[model samples]
Target chain A: MTIKHGGNIYEVAKKYGISEGEIIDFSANINPLGIPNKLKATIISNIEALKNYPDPDYKDLVTAIAKYNNIDEDFVIPGNGATEIIFKIVEAIKPKKSLLLAPTFLEYERALKNVQSDVIYYLLNESNGFNIDKNDLLEKLEDDIDLVVLCNPNNPTGQIIEKDTLVEILIECKNKGISLMIDEAFIEFVDKEEEHSLIRCLADFDNLFIIRALTKFFAIPGLRIGYGLLSNKNIKKRIINKKEPWTINGFAAICGDVLFEDYEYIKKSKEFFRVERENMYSELKKLRGLKVFKPHANYIFFKVLEENIDLKDRLICRKILIRKCDNYVNLSNSFYRVAIKDKESNAELIKAIREVLYED
Target chain B: MTIKHGGNIYEVAKKYGISEGEIIDFSANINPLGIPNKLKATIISNIEALKNYPDPDYKDLVTAIAKYNNIDEDFVIPGNGATEIIFKIVEAIKPKKSLLLAPTFLEYERALKNVQSDVIYYLLNESNGFNIDKNDLLEKLEDDIDLVVLCNPNNPTGQIIEKDTLVEILIECKNKGISLMIDEAFIEFVDKEEEHSLIRCLADFDNLFIIRALTKFFAIPGLRIGYGLLSNKNIKKRIINKKEPWTINGFAAICGDVLFEDYEYIKKSKEFFRVERENMYSELKKLRGLKVFKPHANYIFFKVLEENIDLKDRLICRKILIRKCDNYVNLSNSFYRVAIKDKESNAELIKAIREVLYED
Candidate 1:
């Protein structure tokens, strides 16, 4: 009966009798730069907006998002979060059977279940650093699977599907009448995002759906805003027809104008991550009991060696929380994931892990 | 397909070239005392919380809600808003043929449609002031219908069902294997919410599902928080299993503690509304070309005289927006609904209407 996702800091804080702010949370992969200052100032000054309901149409927000992505306004459907769009897409598609990568974002499976849609998995071998081999994925798509969800810069592993591989899969899926939904929720953190993203191909592929989130890169998970971009008119209509008005809060609607256009924040974030991710990744790799996967995004996925430690509990004991990968369909308890935090925090995490793993 | 809900003051303000703060919005029936000061202060101080993800489990929020409602924590499932709960409940139940009150909150039908469920209506009669007729409803609750939704103090028309009628319906539904859902969203504004609410009956009726919202009562719609209450363990499990984690935002989760426990705000709001509603109802009743329905909640529903004016267009000219009930099933363009606002605003609304109907 426990909620099945990350970012339960309140519960974690209570269990350890610590302030929520005191915990270094890696359970959720949110941007470490925090809310953009401009966005913060806008929200603070416009706190009274909470008194009114959000625009039911969300025209301004949609237009802002469309302009940012250089897409048609009709292609966007903003939601409570990327998760809401995911759930709605599944409901709208009504696929009899869907295919997903093993150990991907846990929510796609939950969304599939909500529609009572059966799921088929294309397991990514742990030895391959959890990368989706395109040939294997295309073969798994076969014919009858109508929906395929790919978590690009995939959660937990932070391993993304390469451009050539993604293009092949998209072409194959289109030929077979299968819808390919790419969750690019963490894409902004990935270096050379333009190279891996299918966003540019959305206009050419009616069967492709792209999910984006402001909660992560914009560092406003508390505001609850995300959207789906797709070219399928029928599916778009079905989603809009099913959506609840004002699902995106008023404060969140203003966020696109503030965060997306905040060039300084974006540039600073990229620069910080360019240096910090490698630092954190190498530091974790240096640890004796863990195998850190090569990360493409802002988080590193690593496995605890069976011989050395209960990594999750060890980290929790130090008042730092990380996501245990056991709940993921294909992963075991030995695997864990942590966000590649800033320099000082990364050092603290490395220090904590060393203390926990190296001690007698 | 424009989303058919009101209180989009931000967008309305933008279109009308008015600041959102200047608009006297009577579209949403939120507490007329405006945002609770304590809740406002809490949000301003915890502005930094937007940097973090909301508690995925919403443990503290749930506990506060349980305490407020005097129910077991397990029986409640919080949502992004009451709308999300409605959407989730329909998906969880996967009802084959559902019966919804015509002229009720629009989301009920939309949610049912998302599941591709067949929806039938028990149309409320104009002669009855849109109140639920228990015998008529009981007759419509055939064994074939898996679900029935009632908006007590029903939207568009603020008529409430008495406790005895609701109890009889609940017991009958249980006997007939029908799931009865009561949306008590506006019940808090009623003189005796406890007496009229099926929340007490929740302990006894496994067949009953009660939907409640903190938005209208607490005046925090922008935060997007609401909860569903049901004693049926099976239904509760189904909902929990299907929910998107972190659906409620951090600011919203904190609201369960701040607003639910703020006795001073609650007392002052109720007092203000008790006087304002009576005054507004009397004023509207006296006005020509409008027939006012008796209101049990924080809004008034009335029909414009056919020969005199188009109320919606007239109100729009005055920069006032009221919900045109035409979009609601069983309601027509001649019908409109308005919120019971604060004393000064209520008087302003009355004067504007008088000028439109009499002087113009």
Candidate 2:
């Protein structure tokens, strides 16, 4: 069987005989505000520009990223998406033995496998609501571990590793000669993202690799643009030298032209998700048969308390799609993740999910 | 120095302090006709759809490609571009000893190098108009060579390897247990493309891999979509299993929704490039200081007869950008390739070259 990832509304839409437009997808954790109006106009205007190849160096795209993050341009490497960066980093590291957070983002494990790395997972404790214990992670970091990958505001669980905790891990890994890679794909969704992010510590940690994406927050997963920030120039050069050219599509290359600077859209989306995530989280917690983990980003994760419930199947029957987390490592069939969408969609999902629970 | 590829109007624009819109680019061999009007409209309509992740399976895309080529869907593997397919094929084959046409597309060599493959070049003799000597190439295909790559209607030289010769090479390579990859990226620009393409023989040779791109023929290089065709499902499966997911962007994936079926646009483009390529070829041949090779695609390759004249520098000063073939293997500073553009632009380029030649 294929190991499916979330955001598979295409498959669901086909299977359920529902038009993609009709389906309220709680599977993909994308921005509820959708693509910014200005970004759409920018894309339309640049349609004719598709005749030319994107800059091979992606100089302007890099500039936008560096300026947005207040980092030097040399520290940024733009990619097709954060997924591309994850794979490239693994290739550059060629880690012989790596440790990853179980129940984190799935791509890192696949990437590690590509490099033939022996992967040891520091399984996040379910009883502890899938939180990463700093001391426990440090103890798990052996000298033989060449790399450690963490998904900040970890996927399917939505538990974030605070900035100070990340620094401790970075330092411990550095001391043990292990590289640290943090994927902050959904960080912008959280309040006080700067306080939680290790961007300021980038210069101090040459071994650090931070993955960011325009996919979720900007709601352009289809456009496929993301970037990585690293202090190590050698690894950065290795990635640039090794990657396939023009991987960034023409529209995607110009995405940052409006994305990083769309202050209004950014503010509006953060505010929307902030309210929706909380409301959705509380609603899910109100359900008697679910144990909702406190969400850190734009998605809420919960485990069905009742056994053998087939909740995803039931929810799909009601034309509401939610991510079944069984495919993720250390996750089970009872574990499900639902994206916090717009107010109306959230209400529909909650109602559908409630009906499924009550019917069981 | 950076090994530059064609279609870098971005770099030229920055260095020359001219707007990219003003520069008539002859470096890239894209279709003379810009993107299809229907495609532009389809993209705009799907602007809101960018919020959703593109169908991961790309079913509609695969169907369009399969239908267009009259091949089984199993035989096709869609990629970010032909460049991505090149890299993926090299990774899947892991060829220890590979033979490639030296003046071919540069990406093949770079891809081969990534796997540390021992690259032996079949240097197309410039004195022989860069033509592939069939007998010489056959003799060079030793049993020990694991892979062989050829760019039909080869890049920078514009010489084609006919179907019969390609079949012979394929059979010989198969017998010797060597994989054969034929890149037909520019074949559509040639009249009777089917006659020159090895596509008909694909079923007979599992070792055969054909790379096709919409970049040049469809004139959407920035959109980034291409595919590789092979009869070997194992290798295809290997590629799919190993590749980074969703490498093809949303807009690029849906490109086929209009591209393959747009018979009117395809016919018009082919008609345009056919006349343009001939006119451009003849015009270049008439130049006093150049020896133009007969072109098979929408581009002409030539050598500057006069020594110590910086032709590219001179032309760029005239606000025209053409490919300097110095970076291509087995090609030198005097070598150049220029795209066959619209008639007016072609005339402008010719006039500029005439001025540069006489000025020298």
Candidate 3:
């Protein structure tokens, strides 16, 4: 079978001979609160804005992002999504040798390959709960490396590197003349995100780059809005020079202002996840044949201990979909990841898993 | 002065110290009929779709484009806009030497420059009304050139190369192992577009590539949907492999099936443009010091015969925006382009120009 990303309900529905709306998707880590009411109202009111072209410079959108992050306007560059910005950065840097985490997001590898950059992997050990070992990681950041990527509250595993440790790595990368990129796509879901984010360090470290997206936290993955931050003047200039204009659509461009200001939605989602993530993790840990990793974001990662268990397939049979992490490097078929949904859905998933595992 | 492209109403509004809604935009060549009513209704009804991630494969959108064009599904690839596809194709082909027309759509050059490809221009002569000379163009197709880009019913100048001449160029490109990319972005606005389009010849010419967009014809530039077509399996495979998933927002993805099926909107737009374009051209020709190039698209290109006339600024003073061709290569301050809008707006533009030129 081909490696697949989550949120692919079209293919999954066909495979299971079921309607898409019937399948409960725990594969993608989107906020359970869903699209904000204010955003929906904004879309309806400004529907006519679709007739005109989006601002080529996307000034309003960038201003909103800069204000939200409390960063300089020069540091913000909005894109079609985090994916486009990743490719643009790789193209601009044209790094000779780059280092990435073994079980990280797949697009980093694909973006680097597009620019013909030689990539080396620093494998995160499963024994350490998929967390990077500071000393081991430092050893891999040799003078020969030109770029290094970190995914904070990393996908699939949902583990975050401590702030001080990340700072040490950043200083080491700067000493070695290597650029460090931290993808904080899921950072907003982490408790005290401002403390964990490296965005503040950007002013002092010219070598640091940070990527953020509204897809996961804002619960609007369908809108496709993401931005990147960097204090390096030369690299930022190169990216802007190479970028295609108006990559963000009108509706997506308008989203940064309204969605980020949605305090009620933000507070409610964080509050829900704060309790639900723990409950979901504890329940899954009760099952005798599974080991659930402590989750820092809106998803949990786990390993099936029973040798012959096909947990993903079993859950899918009950109209539930969980991400099979076998495709990730350094991971085997027994590993899986699932999003922490709302109370009712999480309970339903837990019930289904218990029934499937205990029946045989 | 910084180089500017049309449809930058945001920047123009700021520069003129006026609101965006107050400015009459004749700079962008969008359909005067505005956003199709059906599209507006669909967007309102499907507002909740924004919570879900766009299909990574975009299978349904691609299928709709293929069906609309009467081509095989394998030949289609949807993008954020034509701009994204242009950059992707440049990256995939990695052309050593590319040939482009002078004073064409500027994004093509930017896309090629991003890949560090060597670009050679075939300057369109003003003596020939900015249209390519068949024999002269044929001679420039050197065997060493790897790629050739053409914009049919071209931007700014609004002149199209004859169908027979385009076919000849395609044959030569194929024979010399060069890729031919024809941008049919404005082809839908042309009468009998089927007779002039190279899309149907894809089965016979594997080296041919065509780019199209709904931004202009559907009056939805804010939505940002465009696509590319080619029968070359190898190139298509490379593009898909290198493409970042979900570049299209969910709303834009759903637009393919809805907008393409709006027959009433399509027929009315064609009928509207067929009359308005001629009226605008004839009215502009009545001025004493201007030479209008007969338009084949929704915009008309003209030259100010008299010196020291800042037509763009003068129109701006009247709260009307027209594109200045000074930034385009092989063109000067005397040249300008304006869109054929609704009858009232077109007449207002004509009145503004008359007062600025003859009355002054």
| Between candidates 1 and 2, the TM-score winner | 2
Write the number of the candidate with greater lDDT, choosing between 2 and 3: 3
User: Residue by residue across A1-360, what tens digits does model 1's lDDT show?
Assistant: 354567777777787797877789988888888878898788889888888777788788899999998889988988888988999898889899999889899888888986778899989898888888777777788799999999989987889888899999999999999999999999988898899889999999999999999888888888888999998999998888877777787788777778788999999998888888888888898997888899888888998886456777778878889888888888988898888776788788889988888873
Candidate No. with top DockQ: 2
Tens-digit lDDT track of model 2 for B1-360: 145899888888888899988888999988877899989999999788688788877888889999999988888888898999999999999999999888888889889988999999999898788998889999999999999999988987999887888888999999999999989999998899989998878788899999999999888999999999999988888788788888888887787869998999999988887777788888888998899999999999899988788788888887889998888889889999999888999999999999888864
Clashing pairs in 1: none
Candidate 3 chain A, run of 10 with poorest lDDT: A1-10
* Model 1 score (lDDT): 0.85
Note the Cα lDDT for every prediction shown: 0.85, 0.89, 0.90
TM-score of each model, in listed order: 0.95, 0.98, 0.99
Q: Rank the candidates by lDDT, best first.
A: 3, 2, 1
Q: DockQ of candidates 1 onward, in order?
A: 0.63, 0.72, 0.67
CAPRI accuracy category, model 3: medium
Docking class of 1: medium
Comparison by lDDT, 1 against 3, better one: 3
Which stretches in model 1 have alpha-carbon errors above 4 Å?
A: A1-4, A13-21, A306-308, B1-3, B9-23
Error of 2 at A245 (Å): 0.6
